[model samples]
Target: MQKIRAVVFDAYGTLFDVYSVTARAEQLFPGKGEALALLWRERQIDYTRIRSMAAPDGAYYKPFWALTVDALRYAAERLQLLLDPALEAQLLKEYACLSAFPENLGALKRLRAAGLPLGILSNGNPQMLDISVKSAGMHGLFDHVLSVDAVRMYKTAPEAYALGPKAFGVPAGEILFVSSNGWDACGATWYGYTTFWINRAGHPAERLDVSPSGTGHDMNDLLEFVRTQGAAV
Candidate 1:
């Protein structure tokens, strides 16, 4: 136990449900909506990782917002669906307000009540985070919502993970980074944070050689893990 002083979360797929946009997407594209949404999300993350690796110096870095839009366009073209201006605007608006996970509020409240400082360190750009957090009614739960846009990089990149310790003003060892993405959990663990992997989809660990300090299926499991950690400390 590293005497955790702060809880830093990954916003997109951890606290918020990225698939929530599928409902609106379904309405617009009929039968292919769900496929589009899934592909778009996958492509969005792939773009971030590819760009981050290709532009380690940040000279060719693209904001998450731009990558998101590009991913959407690519998804549409792949599906052979017409992405007119109006439809694109509607889809983008839906993305701006992704629903928070049902467990997020209660888990965050429990962590806050336990005297831990909570923050969000996300790949989302500032406006995207602001809109999503506000829409999810989670704006007050976090003391800081850090965006990688400031560093011109994405997660799995050390510079992006550095935002957590910088925002909390604490050592990486004193912060617990929680994320639904296994790769991100491993990255945070490598960065020296006590990482918790929220394996909500029951996926296996990433092959990155690093492992999370804890693993759970959901936020309730995270709550219990934190409790046990605090007790041990």
Candidate 2:
């Protein structure tokens, strides 16, 4: 609303398709691949949330890489799947190169063309974000990649969201925080950002008082929102 000077995105579900790991997973686990991916992701977020809430004083912190591996192992145990060391290594390797969404590049280019500083504020560690960004061929698109590891916290925590404003040198209201996760969108909004929710899966909104400034089905819609807003300014 204050004329967005920066567009900070959530990396995993928003830019990179976390589900892309399903290819190798399917090969490893056959018909159970989809289930494994879903459960693994669920556990990953659950672990982060638990850690963040359990230590409000920032006493407990684990890098997302560790949490991701732990989530995969837990998911395998829950599903009664055999995840040998070799198979586990392969799965983690595939995850590091998660594919970007089909429209991600074009939309990002459009935003860049509009002269908005683009950044990423994510739970991913620096190395993980670096690998994923390069692998997706989005090497130079971002002006900043702010990882929660810097603050030893996770999203939905105000400190994690504060990284964006700090990185971009802008107020939260001047940053358009875009996330595919409804809870993330809500969190960003509550953190004072003009948020966008990319509801790619058509999921229901989180039961939070905060609502996104805009909602879209994909990056294409995000591009249009940026374009329209840019024109209006």
Clashes of 1: 0
Root-mean-square deviation of every model: 1.7, 1.4
Measured with C-alpha atoms, the lDDT of residue 31 in candidate 1 is 100
**Residue 152's lDDT in candidate 2:** 90
TM-score of 1: 0.95
Relative to the true structure, how large is the alpha-carbon lDDT of every model?
0.90, 0.91
Name the candidate that leads on lDDT. Answer: 2
Candidate 1 lDDT tens digits, 1-233: 66889999998889988775898899999999999999999999999988888878887678888899999999999999999999999999888888889988988888888888999999999988999899998978899999999998898899999998998899998899999999899999999999899999998788988889999999989888887777221
Which residue pairs does candidate 2 place in steric collision? none
CA error at residue 31 for candidate 1, angstroms: 2.5
